[model samples]
Structures are given as C-alpha cells and as structure tokens.
Target: MSDNSSLLRVSNASLLPPLVDWTPPTFTPAAQARVAATMVLFVFAAISNLALLISVSRGRGRRLASHLRPLILSLASADLMMTFVVMPLDMVWNVTVQWYAGDGLCKLLCFLKLFAMQTSAFILVVISLDRHHAILRPLDSLNAHRRNRRMLLTAWILSALIASPQLFIFRTVKAESEDFTQCVTHGSFHERWQETAYNMFHFVTLYVIPLLVMSCCYTCILIEINRQLHKSQEGESLRRSGTDMIPKARMKTLKMTVIIVMSFVVCWTPYYLLGIWYWFQPDMVKVTPEYIHHLLFVFGNLNTCCDPVIYGLFTPSFRADLARCCRCRPPADSPRSLDRLSARHESDPPKAT
Candidate 1:
C-alpha cells in the first residue's frame, strides 16, 4: 500500500505542466498549410512585379528610357521592396511563430511595412490625379514629367512621416513558455486610448482618405471625359471623321483608368476592412487572432499580383513590351525593326500612362 501511494505521487508530479506566462499556440496542419500557401502567393507576386520591371527596362533599354516613367517605376519599386523586405519578414514570422529579428530590426521592419503601404496608397492617388490631368485637363499634360517627379517625392515623404510612429509603437516581447519573441504594436497606454488612436489613424490615413481622393479624382475624370466627348461631337457633327476618332481614342484611355481604379478598389478594400475589424474590441465580444493573421496577408498581397494583370490587360504597349522581352519577337537591333521603333518613338514617345 505504501509503495503504491509513492508511485501515484510520482506520476502526478510527472504529469504537471510547466509554469509560464504564455505558451505558443499549437500550429495546426490547416494553419500551417494556409501560411505556406500565402508565402507561395507572395513569392509569385514578387516574381510578377519583377517581371514587369524587367520588361519595362529591357524594352526601353532596347528602345528608349522615356517609356519607363517615374510613376510606374515608383509603384513597382515599392512593391519590389515589399517582396524582398516586408513579405519575407512576414513569412519568417509566420513560419517560425516568432519575431527573431531582435528589437531594433523589429522596429525598422515594422516602420518599413507601414511606409511601403502608405507609399502605395498615395502613389495611386497621384496616378489617378495625373490621369485626370492627362486626359480632362490636357493643358497640364505638358508638365506631366515634372508633376510625376514632384508627386513621387511627396509620396515617399508623406509615407515616411506616417510610418515614423511605428518606432515608438512597436516592440519585442518574449513568451515565457517558449524561447521565442514577437514584435507587436500597442498603444502608448496599453489599456487606454492609445490603441484607438493608432488604429483609427491607420484606417483613416491609409485607407479612408486615399479611397476618397482616388474616388473623387476618377469620378471627375469620367465626367469630364464624357462632357468633352459630347462637346466635341456636337461641334463636329458634320466633320469627315464625324467626331469618331477623338471619342474612340478617349474611350480607350477611359477604359484603362476604369480597370486600374476598379482593380484597386476590389483588391485593396478587403485588407483595410480587415485592418479596421482587428480593432473592434467591443463591450462583450472578442475577435479571433488566428483568423485575422491568416487572411490579412492573403488580402494585402493580392494587390501586388493585380497590378501586373491590370497593366497587361489595359496597356497594349506593355503587353508588346513584355512579349519583346520574352523573345517572342526578333532581335530588336535588326535594322528594319530599329528603324520602325525609332520612327515610333520619334513621332510620339510612348507616354507612361
């Protein structure tokens, strides 16, 4: 009886769990699969963006650099940085289930992610506004190059200003149950308005304001295009082309803008919605952590892949550029092709839409 009692005590001690503040959550197979798939998508998105850049460079290098406009280059450059810097860090965090880059790097990477996102949002705003100027306000088209440069500069500056707060807001924390750390952002006052301030700021500046600007710009652009088309037709009712040429050309431009704007709304709205939903700490409700993380990346990364598709579909020249880069055409240096390309560029340098 005494020996049996001692054995029971020993078994109880062995079964006891470790004392720790927090334990890493069990990684289920489904979650693991979802992360792997997300990373795979990111990799492909990066590849596609790179392909776009390469095609732009190659086509232009073989032809003229004028085709590689500052706006497209800036947008693509941001996406490329995300692919290399932000996305890889996110993948590492997801896979390892921790933030292993230490505290300093944690701050830098966090800042960069926010900055990259802001840059993307504002770049779209500039693009939409530029599209308006390019089409409806054709008088400004002459200064398009200078305007693009200024906007690109402003976009990065604004993004940096917005992202600066991350340094103060994010920090590294270690799990007591596991030898792992994570970098997370919290309000200055952990249990107070700090969270609300941060959350609302991100939602407003990154999502809401940009949405409004782009929406208004595109709306004005469409209206002006329609108005101008009618005006031209009314005046050219008896002309030989009968206003057919101008309307057709303008419609083509409008169609491209529509695709670009619509794709932005569709691909990006979900990510921002998800971001705001994350902060809905209600009176008697809670949100699941796993659900947000799993889908956040999937939604955000969709925009990266969508850009190239939009370009390929709406920009006929980009498709031709890509094909030429892919070797679907004969050597660009062939005297005949060279002469043709030179004539095309000379007549009208391919405007970066």
Candidate 2:
C-alpha cells in the first residue's frame, strides 16, 4: 500500500493540473533560448525594414521611383510596427509568463498585434494582385499612382477596422489560481459566443478569402505567362530566331512575386491551420509542453521580417532608392532599363515581311 501510494503521487506529478487551477510555469532554460532567438530576429528585421522605408520615402519625388513608393513605404511601415511595437510586448509576456502590464495595455497589445498581422496579410494579397495586373495587363490604368495610393489607404483603413473586434474580445483576466494574471478572452456564454463569432469571421475573411484570392491571382498570372511565352516563341519561330530576351526588370518582378507568395505560405499557413485546429479541438488537443503554441507565436511574428526582404528582392526602384538613401551608387544596370531598351526594340520597324 505504501508503494502504490508513492506510485500514484508520481503519476500525479507527471499530469498537468486542471485549467482553473493552472499557473504559467516560470521560464525554463529552453524557453529563454527561444525568446532570445525571437527577439534577435525581431530586432534585425526592424532595422532592415526601417532602412528600406527611409530609402523608399526619400525617393518619393522621383518619377521612376514614384510607382513603388507607396508599396515600399506601406510594407516597411507595417513590418516596423510589428517588429518594434508588437514583438517586444509579446516577449515580455513570454518572459514573465504573466500580464504585469495593466488591462489597458493588454487590450492595446491585443489590438495592435491582430491589426498588424491582418494588415500584413491583406497587403500581401494586394501586392500579388498588383503584380498580376502589371504583368498581365501592363497597359491598364490600375498601375496609376493616384489609384494605387487610394487603394493603399483603403487597405490600411480596412485592416484597422477588421482588427477592432479584438479590443472587445481580449481582456486581462485574473487567473483562478489567484497568483497570476494573463491576457485572454473571457466572458459569459454570450460573450464567449461573440468571441467565437469574431474568431470565425477573422479566420474566414482575413485568411481564407485572401488566400483564395492570392491563389486565383497566381493561377491567372501563370496562365498569362504561358500565353505570352507561347506568343513570343511563335514570333521567334517565324523569323527563324531563337528567343526574345525577357527583360531583367520583369524577371525581378516575377521572382519577387514568387518569393512573397512563398513566404506568406510559409509564415502564416501554420498559424492559420493551428488556429482553426485549436478552435475546433480546444479540449482534445493539449498545447502545453508540446510547445506548439510558442512555435506558432514565433512564426506568426516572422511574417513581418519576411515582408521587407520580399520587397527588396522584387522591386528595382526600391533597391535603387535604398542605395541612394544609404549613400551608395545604384547598380549600374537593371532590368527596368533593359525593359526600356526592349520597348524601344518593339517600336522599331520590322524587316520587310
């Protein structure tokens, strides 16, 4: 009987306490390692994004740079906000394992984090569609400066509006253990129902719809690329020529779009899938010890880091502006200039048919 009682105590030690009785454990060595890594990445991302923003913003008056200025600024600003503002508070929460900050701060952090995340996602979708329009319909008015600005403004306003529900749903809750406090959504059944509804709305509207739109845009873009390639090949074959040189500028754009899409898929898909899974299996799945929760939180923050890198990769105007701002000479040659040369080639008369 003594041995059996000892065994039962061992089993209880291995088991997690009930939710109502739970307190967040002190940060372990491994947790500290993870938080440190996250903060390092956040700082690096913030600096790079800020540099990119300063570069692009300085080029606002240049005619060639004007086209991408808004895009560069918007993405950089979002990333800066996410990395500097959102991630620091999150790190504090991770370190202390409690909401040492007041209720007001809890609400603000919750709102800012959700708002920035949604804004980043929406901006990515917009950038993808913008690229699709530029490539597939180069002559279209959708690329106009005034229209782009208005669209960007609209995107910002819409992202903020979408994030407003978080303010109402999240609150600083005094844990039942009475020894700790944490930020969580808490309310009666009606309030919980409202939270659930908002969660569903966010999942569907922000992630699902935008994902579908991006997918469709990329599909159309691929189809258009194929069509253009075929036409270019046919033209070459008739002239006994090999290939038309695809402008480096256009290639850069294509590469940028691909990177952006891939990054979005990599950083956010896990979070979205986990969110849905958690929402559905709130009781069946245990997130503690497994550390899936921490993993999701870290990756979700990485989207901010990835955004500016994508911008720098795809946009030559941005790169040029960045170099100029850094007091460095721009690359002597670029795809945009090659594009101009190609356009001039098109205007030249063909040999007698």
Candidate 3:
C-alpha cells in the first residue's frame, strides 16, 4: 500500500512539472529586493495605522470623539481587511508558478480587494469634503452636526455604490504558461466598453469630482481664514490677542489638509497612471520575473495602510481618542482642570461681563 501511494505521488509530480518551476531566472535578485522593500513599507504602515485606530477606539477622551468613531473604524476596518484578505492572495499570485486557488477564489478575491480599495479612496474624499464644510462654515447649522450618524450612513452608501462594478467585471484566466493563471479582465469590444464605463465612473466620481469639491472647499476656507486674520489686525489689543489664536488654528488645519492631499496623490497617482497605461497599451509593459509584479501589488496595497496615519496627524481629538482606545495611560486631566490652571496664572482683575 505504501509503495503504491509513493508511486502515485511520483506520477503526479512528473505530470505537473511545468506548474512548479523553481529556476533562478523566474524571479531576479533586484526584483526580489524591490518586493521585500515594498512589503516592509506596507507592513510598517499597516501596523502604525492599526495602532492609531486601537488607541482612538479604546482611550478616554472627549465625548465629541464619538462623532469620528464611525469614520475611524471604517477606515481601519477597510485597511485591516485588505491587509489580511488582499495582500496574501496578491503575494501568492505574484510568486506562484500557477494559480492553485481555482477560479471561484480568483473572482471573489479580486472583487473584494478592489472594492475595499475603492471604498477607502471614496471615504477619504468624503472626509476632505466634510472638513471643508466644517471649517469654512462653522456657524452654519449643517456644520453644527458634522458628526451626524446619517452622514456616516451616506459615506458607506456612496462607497458601496462606487465599488459595486468591480464585482461583475474582474475575472480569472489561464495564461500562456502551463502552470500559470492570472486574474485579468477579458474585455471584448463589449467588455472593453464596460471597462471604459467603469473607468470613467471611477475617474469622475472618485478622483475628478472629489478633487474639484475639495479644491473649492479648501479655497473657501482659506479665504475665510485670510479675511478673519485681516480683520483681527484692525481690532483692539485684547480683541487682536483673541483673533491671533484663529490664525494659528487655521495654519494647523491648512497643514493637515495639505498633507492629506499630498499623501493621497503620492500613494494613488502611480497606480492610476499604470492602470491607464496598461488599459491603453497592454503589451508595452510586461511584469515578468514574478517579483516585479509582486512589488507593484504591494505598492497598490500601501494606500489603504497609510490613511489612518494621515488622520492621526491631522486631528488632535482623534489622536487622543486613539490613545485611549489602545488602553494607553489616561490624559493628564479634563478641560475644566486646564481652565482652573489658567485662572490661577492670571494676575489682572476680570473684565465686566
């Protein structure tokens, strides 16, 4: 019985010779190095963002912190989902000589992975627009409840709507290599038209329109800040001191907005450009030697990992909440305690109410 089993194993191995090619040329040293570097960066970013999320979710902070809880959780959840669901499958696809996972998994993984990615992108754009409204129109009744539950529901709905098409379009195919299979779109003239439609949807809804909205919002906020600062200069000495605080706060907000926009551009622009290039000139760029493709896959996954870090830097309340969520030491004291300290430090008599 043992001899028969061994013989069957040998026969199977012999029959599947091309499927498990392990030659050195299959993945060059430089390509491997690039993959390693990208993987390291991706892991680091993911871990950092996860830590930030944990800290915010558990820590003792202001009640207003609850307002951003949904958004933070959504971002972190998407990133975490991608790290586990997408990255491993992508790594396997890039390195293996064949598609061992079958067609069902290929379609499911491709759909879920791209859907999460698109969802994350859409969420970020929503956040930018939300911030713009809050900052520019602080007195407006709408801005008063920027953290409304309905707003979060809308964000999720929009994200889902934006990502839905990926489910139907992505497909797995057997490739030229005997052992190898890949998940690629089989775009016939009709399918190609569908691809074009989805691409335009992605471009217009996710990138172009969001960016324009962000630009307009930021512009209005900046102009408002500038006007406030100019008005501050002509005020009484005490009023000037009060107004001076606005400029500092505005500067911080501006810095955060710039960083968020820059991070979005840096992480996404290459992937989008490469995607467009591939769509138009599929033969021009070949990702051979397995590892090069691995690097590109890792690079694309990094955006989801990096978003939480951007949020942490921009929002102080978020940072404080994140610390609490992770079971970090409690903050020094409440806002009332700080007020008492300020009162003790002042020597001048109180002004008339």
Sorting all predicted structures by TM-score, with the top scorer first, yields 2, 1, 3
RMSD of model 3, in Å?
10.0
Residue 14 Cα positional deviation in candidate 1, in Å, after optimal superposition: 36
Displacement of the residue 338 alpha carbon in candidate 3, Å: 14
Give the per-residue lDDT of model 2 (tens digit) for 206-287.
Answer: 6788888888988887787677577667774343322233334444555676687687788777767766654545542443
Error at 318, model 2, angstroms = 6.2
Residues 1-353, model 3: lDDT tens digits? 00111011111111122334432224445445655665676687667667756654664312223334555566677677667665655445435523567667756676666566656665666556555654554434233235545666676677666665555555454533344454444442254445555555675665566667667767777786677666667662246553343334334544665576666667655555554554454443444333434445456666765566666655555555655656896456443221222223111222322
Clash pairs, model 2 backbone: 249-335
Residue-level lDDT for 49 in candidate 1: 81
Q: Which regions of candidate 2 deviate over 4 angstroms?
A: 1-20, 59-65, 188-194, 236-248, 284-288, 314-353
Against the unseen true structure, what C-alpha lDDT does each candidate score?
0.59, 0.61, 0.51
CA RMSD per model (angstroms): 10.4, 8.1, 10.0
TM-score list, all predictions:
0.78, 0.78, 0.70
Higher-scoring candidate on TM-score, 1 or 3 = 1
